[model samples]
Structure formats: C-alpha cells, structure tokens
Target: MLFLTSRLDHTDEEVFKIKQLRQLVEKCDELCVGTDDTMLTKFLHYTRWDTIKAYQAIHAYYEFKRRHPTWLARHSIEHYRPLFYGTHCRFVMPHVDRDGRVLVIFKTVDGFQRFPDYLQSLVEMDDLIFESLLLLPRVQEKGITVICDLQGTTRNFLRQFSPAFMKVVNEKNGVLPFSQRIVHIIQRGFLMHVTSTLFMPFMNKEFKERIFTHDGRHLSKLREMVGYESLPAEYGGPASNVLDTDLIFNHLLQNADYLEKLQKYEKL
Candidate 1:
C-alpha cells in the first residue's frame, strides 16, 4: 500500500483556498476533521477546488462516521481475508489507469457461498481500499476506476447482492472522500441485465452516468478506456499483470496501522 508521494507545490491561490477550508473545518468542533495539508488538498482535489463543496464533503464524511458508530466499529480486515484464500473476490490492481486513477478489479469467481458475512466483508474492504487509495496524491487527484469481472459469477452470488445492500453501499459511497470515476461491468445478456437492474436504483446520477457496460466477447473498448497495460491478463493485458493474491495481501498488511487508526475513527 506504500507508494512514494510526489511533493505537490500548490499555487498561492490554491494554498489560500486550503487555508480557508481548514479554518472553516476547524471552527466546527463537532466535525472530527483532520487539518493535515495533504488530506485537505485531497478534499479540494475531488471537489474541484471549490472550497464550499469540499467543506460540505468533509462534513458529510465525518458525520457519516459519527452516525454509524456501531457499523464502523465492527470493520475488520479478517472479514475480508477469506476471499483471498479461495475466490479472490476483490482486489485493487497493481497499476493505475491512463488517467493515473487507481483501478480496483472485482471478480465473482467461486461466489460467496462460503462467506455468509460477505456484505460486511465487502463494506470493510471498500473502506480499507479507499482509505489506502486516498494516501496517494495521484489517486486523490484522479479518482478511481472499477472493473467488475463477472466471468464466473453465479446466480447464487448475484442473489446475495440484493437491492437493500446496494442502497447501503451507495450511501457509503456518497460520504467517502475519494471519487469513483467509472465502473466497468463485464457481463452480458440476462446476467448483466439482472445485475444492472439490481444496483441502478441505488446509484447516484454521476455514478450512473459513469458506468460503462462491456460484454465478455469484446474488451477492446475497456482496453482503450484504461489502457492495455493497466488491465490484468484475464482482460487481455500482460501476463505479468495477472492477479496476485500475495501482492494484494502484502499491500494490505503494510497498511495495517492505518486500518487500526480507521477503526478508531469509526468509533468517533
């Protein structure tokens, strides 16, 4: 999870805006907003440097944590660990896309029959991964791109991803600091239709607009969207870019401290 952060030199105007944002956030004692420059910069980055929008986003973020204390308190990496040993349900890619946005690849291989707590596990993983991605300035600036490979997915698996669950996820997505640039769903015909119908109701306008569906038959568009080098071998990228559980586990382990801190923040 550790990557070198480039020294970002903000313009005088940008610095002033961040200072303004910091002052505004600090004044609100109820909001557990950190005044770190880098963190504030990320807020500004995602909100397109609009100070008011960034402040609102920051407020919404802390407020969500404050309201969902019980939910956040139970967040654990252990819940998501089972996926790695067998199904490899979800993992962030080793490289960024053409726009320098982080790529998060999700697979439905083997389904989640073994894990009854899959929903909670997915929630914790989302929080952990987004928190990790926010550490990189490039990711903060460019947002994230998601590729959902539903190649081996089953009807039983789709069954678990109910509309109610998607509603909760969508609400969480709204408050998270990082942006989701797009979602590429790899499925077709009836299965794709079912999946789309299940989640579309919960998606925000921007999120819905950002989605790009692709059938398994043709991935040329996906390749063009994210660049061939950015994808894994299963999607027609280099074999070296194939999914590696060890690499993913190593990254998560390295960020163990942050996850601990995140649990603490969740309790707040």
Candidate 2:
C-alpha cells in the first residue's frame, strides 16, 4: 500500500514493504508501506501549532487540494482523527472551559464565510457557541480543527453582554460594538458538518489527569473516549492510544516502522 506521512514542514509518501518494517522502538517516526493482498493506502499526520498558526497548518492541506484538482480526481485524501480519539466524530464538537469561556476555531473557511445561510443562522446562536469555528476550506482534508477554548467565565460573560449593549446603540444611532459587528458579518455554514479532532496529549499521566479534570463536568463523547483507556482489541478499539496516530506521532519519533512500508514503493 502507499503510505503518506505529513508533518509541520513537509509531506512525503512511499511504498512500504513489510520486510522493511524492522522490529525496533526507535524506528517509529518512519512511515511504512505494506500490502496484505489488498488496497494501497497513505495515512498518518503530525503537526502542532501554538495558537493561530496551528489553524493555518491545518488549512494549508485544504487549499492545497482545492488548488490542485487533477491530484484530487484520482486520489482521495482521507482526513483522519487519531483512533484513540476514536471513530465517533462530531462535526461541531464545541468545548467550553470550566470558567465558561467558549473557544471558537477557524480553519476550513474562516469565521463562517463559506457556510450557507442555514448554517450561518446557527452561528448567531450565541448561547450555543461561546467560541467560533476556525474554518479553512483549504485544509479540511488534513484532519485538523483548531483548538479554541474560552478565556474564562468572566470574559465570556462580558462578551455576551457587549452584544445587547450594541443593540441598544444600533437602536439609538445604528452603532454596534466591534464584537457585535464581527458577529453581524458572520457567514452561515461553519457549524453545518459534525466534526472532531484527532488529538494526542503531550503531557504525562499527572498532567493529563489535571488538565482533563478542568473540563470533566462538561463531558463530550470525544472527551470520554480520550479520558478512558482504549476498548479491548476484539471490540474494535485500535489496540491502544500508544499505537494510535495522534499520541504516537505526538509523543515520539523513536520508531518509524509505520513509514517503512512507503519506502519500498518508488514514488513517495
């Protein structure tokens, strides 16, 4: 099969021959390719963004595919969520912090501009989305949905009040707060599709326990899965987050057997 491994700075594909997949922990960073009398596939991605630029890295893929139609017609880029994040994905799995501030991420098509009117209608549902969806049409296939969480409860509450305050102005003299103005120009389709992210936590057990607890009260299906151990192998869970792309890619480059298969093929 054809295997493609994408990271922050570059993307490469190769043909993996199981023969090349050595049995060693250190080879993890390598992408491998192999066939069991079946189809060829390319998968695996590694990326990290500090804040806003993170969304850009995700968006780049979408734009890349859009700009190159010929490449797309023949090959389908399967946007993946790390298996530990599991297959039960949500199109708009919005999360709010314990403090009540909501994070809005924009990637596929920023600030809702690409969405249709129906979807746009939902954006104005301020109560539902404390934060915005960072959209970037160009990177939809890259399997990235940016991370944005509310700053805190006080800040989020202030944001809510600013709108009504603006309406008072619009009524008196047609002036609106900058936040309200941004909301008014909002596009419609950002939340139309149910999506989720494939994330690998960088912290160790103590760190994960602490951070995961902050938002435990507002549990999401994705969060539940992430917080729990992988389902037993016979049940279809992907063995463990250790083998899953998100954590494996995030935690270490010690082994690259997965990338070994790709090398066997000439084209990577």
Best by TM-score: 1
User: Candidate 1 on 64-130: residue-level lDDT in tens?
Assistant: 7776653452545655676666666667777888888888887766545676766555556656766
Best by lDDT: 1
Candidate 2 steric clashes = 59
User: Candidate 1, overall lDDT?
Assistant: 0.74
Instruction: Tell me the whole-model lDDT of each prediction, alpha carbons only.
Output: 0.74, 0.23
Q: TM-score of predicted model 1? A: 0.86
Please provide the root mean square deviation of candidate 1 (C-alpha atoms, Å): 2.8
Residue-level lDDT tens digits of model 2 in 1-268:
0012232332222222211222221233332223321111111111221222322322343333344322211211121122113321112212222222222232122222323331222222221111111111112123222122321112222323344433332232111011111110111222221111111122234323322211312334423333223322212223432222332222212223322232232211
Tell me each candidate's TM-score: 0.86, 0.17
Worst 10 residues of 1 by lDDT: 69-78
